[model samples]
Each structure stands twice: as structure tokens, then as C-alpha cells.
Target: MPVFPKISLRPEVENYLKEGFVNNEVVSASGKAAAERKFEALLNHLSHPPSFTTVRVNTHLASVQHVKELLLDELQQVWQFNGLSVPVLQHPDLQDVLLIPVIGPRKNIKRQQCEAVVGAQCGSAVLRGAHVYTPGIVSASSFMKAGDVISVYSDIKGKCKKGAREFDGTKIFLGNGISTLSRKEIFSGLPRLRGIGIRMTEPIYLSPSFDNVLPSYLFLQNLPSAVVTHVLNPQPGEKILDLCAAPGGKTTHIAALMHDQGEVIALDKIANKVEKIKQNALLLGLNSIKAFCFDGTKALKLDEIEDTEGTPPFSPESFDRILLDAPCSGMGQRPNMACTWTLKEVTSYQPLQRKLFPVAVQLLKPGGTLVYSTCTVTLEENEEQVAWALSTFPCLQLQPQEPQIGGEGMMGAGLSGEQLRQLQRFDPSTTPLRDTDLETLRDARAEDMIRLANKDCIGFFIAKFLKWKSTSEKDPQK
Candidate 1:
């Protein structure tokens, strides 16, 4: 049973998405009937959680086996329910991956006396194994006290005002929980906020919280995000570039993969986001990453004798590899009950992404790798960009990915079937979970977990290209 119905969207957004699925040539070619079915499946799946929860055991600091044992022990202690053991399985393909099935929409959880309203983002996090943080609490019962049992509701429409006495606007029931703080403590004077306001005891979805749980030995990252790092494959002793890198999830992963060897330059347009990158690097103990606040689209050096070792505006062919995880209309994010973006706002990312691509290509050494990826499902952002790139740059050729867990590229961009095969796309709607023996999953290998993790992920696209030896038209190689 689904806990939430297929996320309700504004009429305009719904019509826009429906037209894309019905009239778009790429979707029509997949067979109109099949396309419609897939769209429905996407909607259904979006309202629910993924089949497995992936945790990247920080093997850089702790051994995989050791972390696995510790996590199992912790799960037993934290998630004990009537002496019944909750299964914590290791991923078959990724060595560091740990999988835990979410037990959800519990049959019997009585509504409590007190009520706490949270915003949609906080509600989604609660569904996916996160405890309610202090700031997410929007409104609480006037008489609510510490340890009082309460039922949480998510204000999906984002219309609920903070510190309200009561809310009758739009909201959804999340689950039952116990208040960790009194109403006064949660809504009083400055510096009143100190700790967790609510502790979820009977969440609709049952998954262990990873908060402060083996922070150094494990990172709670989505499976597709992990795949992005592996596909980039940043090697040791090489200089790499990550454009639009913020909050430093992939940036830190790259540095860790390189064993903290060589320079990993990370750039983001926002100054505050750059600070977050540095903070994540410090927390992860990665010293090789150098993050700067600069726009990647304008990262081209015009001077003959520019500073070679500084941030951005670098000379051509400066990096061995570049990752342009460009921003886009994040329609693929799950549990998004509503999106207020206009069509114009949603279609505005392509030009910016295109502007950044050339800089990334010019900054790469001859024979260097450039990976362009996005967490989006739009044709304009994914396949169409690949088509445009191939036609624009004679030196660039789509290269095959090492671990191709996602489906091939979708068909609307005039790319050939073989060309599409070379690209990787993690379309959550297409892949289905396979049932394997319990014992087999328990003793799964690292490669198996990586494979499984790759397939079961958010909608994403990855296109890797290798620059030719030379770009000059008069070259003998040409």
C-alpha cells in the first residue's frame, strides 16, 4: 500500500509534464502506450520510498567488514521491536554499500493528542530515516509538553506560517512520535533552540536514523550519487576540476578516492556554498580539495602570463578531468508533493549548462576526460545536450562508461541507438528490483552492491567524452 498518493501537482505543471510524455517524439517512440505506463509508474514510485536505503561505509577510515559489524550491532539496539530482528543487508555490488528495507505505512498507529506540523522537506526526510530537527517544527499544540505523544503532519503546500497556534491549511499525516521539547522551549525567545524537538517513535516508514551514527566510518549518500563519483573515477596524483561543486558530497568523495593525493579544485558560484564545501572537506579529513567561490562558465584564462596555480580563469588544458554536475529543473527528486516552478523557470537551465560546457572542455588537457551529468529527467538537459555537444565539438566523442548501471539514453535527441548505449541514465521508472536469495544478499560481493546501487537510483544522466590528441585541423592525426 502507498503511504501517499501520487504527488499532487499544479494544473499547469501537470499538463506540462503530461504533454512531454504524450507529444514528445522521444517519448512517443518508446510506444505511446508504454510511455504512458512508464509515466504512471514514475508518479507512483515518486510518492513512495526506494526499495533499499544505501549507506556508504567510510572505508577510507574504517574497514568495510568492521563497519558492517558495528552497523549491525547498532541497528539491533536502535531498532528492536518486540524482539523481531530487522534485516540489514549489504549491497551486492558496492563494497561500502549497506541496504536496509523500509517497513512502512504500519497497520496500527493511533493518532495522538498533540499535533506538530512540519514543512514538506522535513516530512520527506522523516520518511527516509531522519529524525525531526529543531528548526523544521513549524507549529505545535499550545499545551504540548516534553515527552508528550504527538502526531506529525507535513504542510505540503508550504502555506503554513511558522509559530502558528494551529493549522488547518493543507497537510499530510506522517506518523506518531514523542515530543522532545515543550511548546515554550520550541517557540520562545532567542537562543531557545537547542536540540531535537521531536523524536519519531512510530514513523510511517521504519528506517534507522544515521544521525551522528558512525559519522567518520559511514556517509549517508543516495546510491546514484555514489555512482557519479565512480563514473568520474578521479585517479591519484592528478589534478581534477568539479564545477558547481557545493556541499562537497562528490568533491569529498573524489578526494577520498584519490587517497587525498594531488589537487582537487572545486568551484561554486555562491560564496556561502563554497564555505560549505570547505566545511565538508574538513569534516571528512580531506586536505587535497581546494574550493573557491567562482562561476565555472567564465573560467577561461585570457592573459599570456596569468597566475597558473590560482582559482578559476585558468589557462586552456589545465585539468586532467572535469565534472560539470550542472544545475537543472530537479523534477526527478522523490516525494515532492508540489513544485511551483513556472515552465519558463524550468526551461532556463540549458543556456547556462551550455555556457559551462565549453569552459569545461577547454580546461581539459588533450586526451582528458570530461563528464557532464545532471539529476534531471528532461530531454533538453540530458540527451539534447549530448547531441549538441557532438555537433559543436569535433574533438569530443562519447566514451563508454565503466559501470553502466542505468538505462541507455532516451530517444528524442536524434542520437543513434549505439550512441545512446554509450551513455548512462539512471531512470528509476525503468529499472525493477530483482528478488535474490537472502543468504546470497547477506554475503554479497562489493561488485554486486555497486551494480545494484547503480540501477536503483534517482533519475540522472552521465555522458563521458575524451578529447582527441589535437584539435588543430592541419594535424596529421586529423
Candidate 2:
């Protein structure tokens, strides 16, 4: 039953997560044994890739059907050598989604004496169907040649040296690949990676690489991530603000939903990330987005200058809708294999989220919507934050979401059933990994496969709220 090792966490961090899952509410609902089992399942699930690879069709450029056909053609051409024929299916609930089953933790491949090691992040990408980029190669065999077959390993513990001759630390095997760059070329080729360093000939997992495959027609996004924009439900010609937008997946999605007619202001703390957002918007041909390199918490305008002109520090209640896809510990990402974070680092996001919450509320117009989301499974960042939001801001009320595919909020947060139902928690712990065979998957019913894809995705949480206060309502914080 065990495919990959359980996700590695510090003892304290593991205990913290354990306590939250085995809390009173969860125990009362699912019993002690079941809750513990779920927790164990979660740890194991995180180390392995999800059953399906989800992509959101860029509906602005082409129809979902059109993109699906193009993707199928490309995948068939790429996999023709290995006779890999995976059927690409549309999500029943989400018309814009296309799901392709990821096929392995394939255990039959023999290891090669020539070895190459990649960083944890790059290793995760390989599991999700990416070739090893040159910059991500941490260490390679000293005598490794470019065409040599190499056993690829992920330095999951982060102990591998940058240019070491060999590493004896804890590493997980990620199958075999052909080295495209020698160790000399890898070390010398600095500043930027010239090309893909390792071309995977036999990956532990089998999924299609989207490197140059219809980049404009489709976006490689997790299923729940695409769902966040849909729950925000950005209408055409409405003023929307993405509080912590970077690399602009959701921001671009919102603009596309608005038919590229309305203003979609995106903010990120980093300048490079802001540029990435702009690039995504440009690539998608969506011009309604304006990305700013500024803190989302300090975005509110306390000054009397009513005309701030399309910049940061805008007047109160300026946006018609807001999306706070807040930064978190990111524990919910799959194929993580390990987390080298201390307990302090793991628990540091709640305060930042709270600071951003009030600012989002202040910037939203009366009767506007605010959708808060995180790519994490923690109670503090998910349910606990929702409870805090409701108590601190009376204007914010939990609102129901369409396509409620994820499970209800975890217990022990003091939220009622109805309140929890309004929150969507895509907990990987609750959803066991399914068989990832494409042939057998094709035989399954569409509804069954769609449900499987929804649950077997990156762990995510989303909470939508409606601001019920009037325009004249006084600021709660002030």
C-alpha cells in the first residue's frame, strides 16, 4: 500500500499537525482510530503525486473542447514511443478543466551507477512531469558524461552540497534519466540554465510535460486553485483586487472571467513576482490587470487624497470584490516528500493573514465579495482564521460556494455545521490516493473520475464572505 515515504517533518511540527487533526470535533465526528488513520494517510499522500494532472483551459483564447483536443494530440505524439496513451477527460463540474491521470510510483526500474541529485523543489516538479532544469541540479557524479544514464535522486533532507562529488545523506530515488549536461557544464553554466539537465527516460511517475504544449490555450493549475476564482465569481466590469497575487494565476483567471473589460488590481510584496503577474497577463492577452509591487496589508489609504490614480493606498471600499489567497505554511502541496521548516516557521502565517484580512475588508465595496484561500491544511490558517474573521468583522458573513467539491471545514474551530459547509477544505488526508492507471481510469464513469480528481489534488482551503455592511458603516478597526 505504501508507495513513497511519509512526508518528513520536525517532531514538534508533526505533533502540532497531529493535535489539530485528532482534536475533539474531528474525533467526535470520525472517532479516534479513523482520525489517526487519516493523519497517517495524509503524511503518506503528501510524498506521492496526485492521481490526476489538472489544467485550466484559457477560455479567452479557445474553447475547453479545442484545448482538450490539442492537448490529446500533443500527449499522444510525445508518448507514442512508450505506447503511453492516456485519455484526457473534462471535469463534469468544471467545464474548463481537463484531467490526465498520473501513472506511477513505478518500482521496477533498475538504478544506474552514475547518479545525479536535484533539489527538493525540482524533484517535486519531476514527480509532476517536468524535466530537470540545469539550475536545480545540486550534485552529479564527477565522471558523469552528458549522454550517460544516471540514477536521479531528490535530496529530500536538503543536505546535499551544491557541487559535491558525491552525497551520502538521505535521498529518495526518483527513477533514472539521461544527463544532458556534464558536471563541468552544470557548474560552469551559472546565472542561467542553458537547457534541461536531465531528460527523464523512466520517471517514477508518468505525466505529460507542458513545456511548449499550448501555453496560451491552457494554464497548468491545481484543480482547487482554479475553483478559488470561480467561487470569487468575478463579474464583468466589476472592480476586483487580488490581495496577494503573484505569478498571477488567479488574477489572470479573474480578468478572463470578466471578459478583460474590468480592472483587476493585483499586488505582491516582491518586484519579480509582480513582473511575473504582468507577464502572465500579457501572455494570456488580458489587459484589465494592473500588478503592483506593494504590501497588501498597507494597501488602504488613510490619507485624504481621494485621487490616488490606479496605485496602492487607495480609498476605503474601492474594490467591488477581493481575493486574499494568503501565504501559508504550504503544507498541503503534494509530493512534498519533506518539510525542513521549524515549528516557528510553520506557524508564522496566521498573523500575516490577519493583518491582510482587515485591509481586504476595508478595500471592498458594500455588498461586495471577499474570497480567502490558502494552499494549506492547518486549522490556524483555515478554519481558525474564518472564526476570527467572523468575530472581528461583523460585516463579513460566510457565503456558500458553487461546485462545493472539497470537504467541510475541520472541527475544533467552534464554527457551526452550516458555517463549516460554506468553507471548502481540500484535505488530502480524507481522500485516499486512487489507482492511477490511464487504461483502467478510462473505463471508469466520468462522474466518478471527476470526483476523484477534485479530491486527489493539491491540499487547499477556500472561504468566501459577503460584506453585508452599508457604505456609511464605520470602520471597525478605527
Q: What is the alpha-carbon lDDT for the whole of candidate 2?
A: 0.89
Task: Supply candidate 2's per-residue lDDT for 407.
Answer: 89
TM-score of each: 0.90, 0.96
Strongest candidate by lDDT: 2
Candidate with top TM-score is 2
Q: In candidate 2, which residue ranges exceed 4 Å CA deviation? A: 79-82, 191-193, 471-478
Tens digits of per-residue lDDT for model 1, 1-478: 3557776667776676666655567555777888887777676656665656778766567678898889888787775233445566675545566776555556578888789999888988887877787789999989899999999988888888999978999888888888888888888744756567888988876777888877777777777677777788889999999988987888888888888899999999899999999987887778999998998888888785877577777888878999888988877776566666778888899999999998888888898998998887787898889999999988898989876767898777889999999998777776553333334455676455555545555677889999985553476676
**Tens digits of per-residue lDDT for model 2, 33-86:** 999999999898988888888888888888888889888878878852256667
> Any idea what lDDT model 1 has?
0.79
For residue 175, model 1's alpha carbon misses the true position, in angstroms, by 0.7
Off by over 4 Å in 1: 23-28, 79-84, 431-456, 471-478
lDDT of 1 at 350: 93
TM-score of structure candidate 2: 0.96
